[model samples]
Target: MPALLRIGRTLRRTLLQAIPTVLGIVILNFFLLQLAPGDAADVMAGEAGSATAESMAALRSRFGLDNPVLVQLGHYLNNLAHFSLGFSPRYGMPVADLIAQRLPGTLTLMAFALTIAILLGVILGSLMASFAGRIPDRLLSIFSLLFYSIPSFWIGLMLIVFFSVKLGWLPSGGAGTIGSRLTGLPAILDKARYMVLPATSLALFYVAIYARLTRASMLEVKNQDFVRTAYAKGLTPFGVTARHILRNALIPITTMAGMHIGGMLGGAVVVETVYSWPGLGRLAFEAVMGRDFTVLLGILLLSSLLVIIANAAVDIIHAWLDPRIGAR
Candidate 1:
């Protein structure tokens, strides 16, 4: 089959696979939130004071909490069908609107984090691979191991202390001062400065794994006949590796990186919460705590969609990078 035609077919298949995953996430999260102990109205009133039957009944009616679980779920599905996310009980706003408000901050944070992971991980991995079996390689290997095992929260605290307290360079904890918000280039840079520590800490885990993956893949690819053939033909080491080694080595790393992007974007709750960044993670955290089912379901569903879309992207990339893959 023609390469372009083959790629189209593969992409179609990939997107088709993603549909079921999206549905599954919606169904599962909705049910789990429903199954979670305590009724929604009760959760709302529990923190307020005593749960009078009349007041409780009123609260249930107010939120349509009187409906049977199945009916409520059916309504949810119907609302979802109409592309409506409904209002968040906690935020007293549409879940969709809340997501829109916070998504940019979350995206801004995750983009920097992804950038850090890719730059450092690829560079470190390439260096380690080039110097395989040497002191530099061993040291990097050990460092990657250590970085991978550390908890993000612990790393955040350490970064705050050593960088913020000891050196007095970065902020200790939080996104920024309330009134100091700026924009344009200077504002962006300043935000990045506040962002550097948490982004770095959040990225460390992915970087360690990706670096290891890259180093190993590159090292193995370097032994291939195509790479050696390029070298034997008097191509410069850099030229040969750039054209040959990295091309082949990037296949696995691309998959790993793409899949991780969704997690980093969606599952960044801990890092976001630790830094008090006003993003989806922190928002989702509050939603779950308050048993704001609408908000929680929306975030969970959005996260699941990200993961599915990410995987579809990875598959498309895989087919592009390695035409031999699923090329039948």
Candidate 2:
């Protein structure tokens, strides 16, 4: 029943769930990539008569394409064990390095957007729940519904026009200017300046979702016996609500937020493409167009890893916050 021991078991269970997910991603991507319409080797080699015949054979042998499907998959898995996702034969670079370089942009944007969304969602949701069925709550219900209905790509374009073009307050697309590196503060400012509009656009949809979730959670927790008891014990309305109601409602929000982290990355694909941010989303989109198999596989594997980790985090947070589940 000890908290530490309970946490250990919870973590073990979470990790165990990851094994099949990882294997599934590897297998699915492998088969699907094979099913696609062209020979990866030929695609990388370019036109049949364009490159020297001898050199094409060498490239194929170098990447292990000389082997059969099963042999190739085994080689792929072996390389993956050493953390070599694959080398992009087409791009002539390591896939892992490529993904690592672009990961920061996606992480920075997503982290900022999630922070803004959670802070705004919890606050607005709390207010909505507090004034449930009243005029303010009704207005919020309408607002969230309307905001949620807008497409992400459309919103990104609107933000670009209104803020970047019309007002000229933010950059139209690029993450930073050419010489941002020459000045540290300017680079940081430029980085954030470009991120603001895109991050805001991404945050809006999430806030709409989280607000509704928080509002429902707060309403449920508000009716619990602990809240009633605190109210009966001469506690002020705010005090009773803050200590008992907020703490209980937090468990649901924590779980929801953790689960949604992967969804944010998926959404980033559309958002990053819209703004032309140099991130995994844009990279994967480009890879598919170019028929860059190694890059596509790397992206799929990284995405699977991220989603699995997010799910594990949700379970761990759930156990930590509510010891009742940890006990079992």
Candidate 3:
């Protein structure tokens, strides 16, 4: 009961602290975009071709772009308080609806990418840790360094060239085949086929990071007194390493994994652009090009919320994994 109470208090405090962080992100995302020249009204007016001054003025007025920045901010906040994400002037649809439409694709991509990263990272990291000072460790270290150093966009393009263009094993771009009527299992397979290149591209950098982190963490824990004691107590070497050393090493891995959620989403912008996957990142790119402030801000706000939630969940997991964290 006391532990539960402590964890509850920690959660409450985390949430309280997050309020100011989220508010600051909202302000920054809104104002920074506003500071940039041009807006949805300008884009709309220009796209219309030879529009009159009065028509441009009316467009600005219609989208409330004529309002002062602070006034617009207030309106946005007020709408947010009412659970509203403002409409996108470019799309003629609510920003929330647009996000909802695109979110599933992004979620699916993230899920596959993250799962692959974790599995491969842990396995490779364990191998490196177990064979420290050996040929395999040296080889993996070089591999991880290369993976970490390369840009995701470059990796994505290279993957497309090799897997899609040369070998022709996968689709080069897009979430699915264009103008296809495939359905059910066939549709699922088609999407998965298209996903392979992008997911691998997105997952590679994180895999490298996690592999290095896991290797470092496991090595750090491997020599700890508890692990030595466990070994001394007649525990098998494998048992001491796997059941004890790996478990403790995972704390830092968990932390890195949770914190990387935002970064992964940001990276998706590049990966999705390269792959032409229609996810939130692609939507964000479109919004920026179109100066769709509502959709852009909506995406930023949603990303911030996801990051905060992920961090909060990490804190809770930390507490569960090591009760001392809850007490702190």
Q: Rate the local accuracy (lDDT) of all candidates.
A: 0.83, 0.85, 0.91
lDDT of 3 at 126: 93
Per residue, candidate 2 scores C-alpha lDDT tens digits across 127-207 of: 899999999999999989877999888999999999988999988786887664546777788889889988988899989
TM-score for each predicted model, relative to the true structure:
0.93, 0.91, 0.94
Model 3 clash count equals 0
Q: After superposition, how far is residue 271 of candidate 3 from its true place, in Å?
A: 0.6
- List where candidate 1 sits over 4 angstroms from the true fold: 1-7, 265-267
Which 10 successive residues of model 3 have the least lDDT summed?
319-328
Off by over 4 Å in 2: 1-5, 41-62, 182-186
Q: What is the lDDT of residue 168 in candidate 3?
A: 92
Instruction: Enumerate residue pairs that collide in model 2.
Output: none
User: Any idea what lDDT model 2 has?
Assistant: 0.85
Counting clashing residue pairs in each candidate, in order, gives: 0, 0, 0
In model 2, the worst 10-residue window by lDDT is 40-49
